[model samples]
Target: MGLFSRKKEIMVGNICPKCNMEFSEPQRTLRHIEKAHKSKKKFECNSCG
Candidate 1:
């Protein structure tokens, strides 16, 4: 192996639904989604027109 040679990084984690960000840990991904994409309302309500 050369001095500058490096091993390839393997991504083994969950991906965010909203964004395509990868996380090594499931908990971290969940936390990031909650904090980054937190909705103002607890639930979304739809009304019939």
Candidate 2:
């Protein structure tokens, strides 16, 4: 793509009002807010750490 030829921003769902994070699905966006911003860490790895 050229410099002037920009890509389009597709909105599959709503953007997060709190952090301005874009998500394709509404459920996924909600989950992201809860996990990342709401201090709900539920998907931690034991071997990776």
Candidate 3:
């Protein structure tokens, strides 16, 4: 019945390897690692003639 539909709750079991944080979705966990744990590298351009 559309009137009495129950949504299943997802359990959070995904853990971040860097921070050990729990996330419900895998995507959120990956995002957290990229933002907090992983460091961003800057690229430098050199011109040679």
- Top-scoring candidate (lDDT): 1
Name model 1 segments beyond 4 Å from true: 1-13, 41-49
The model with the greatest TM-score is: 1
Each prediction's RMSD over C-alphas, in Å, is 12.8, 10.0, 10.0
User: In what order do the candidates fall by lDDT, top score first?
Assistant: 1, 2, 3
Better of 1 and 2 by lDDT: 1
Taking all chains together, the TM-score of candidate 2 against the true structure is: 0.47
Candidate 3 residue lDDT tens string, 1-49: 5898786554334898767889888878867776787575465457731
User: 1-49, model 1: which lDDT tens digit per residue?
Assistant: 5999886654435898788899888878877877898878566658732
Give the range of the ten consecutive residues with the poorest summed lDDT in model 1. Answer: 40-49
Name the lDDT value of residue 1 in candidate 2: 50
lDDT of 2 by residue, 1-49 (tens): 5879865643436688778889878878867766777755667799986
Per-structure clash totals for the candidates: 0, 0, 0
Q: Which stretches of candidate 2 lie over 4 Å from their true place?
A: 1-13, 39-49
lDDT of 1 at 46: 81
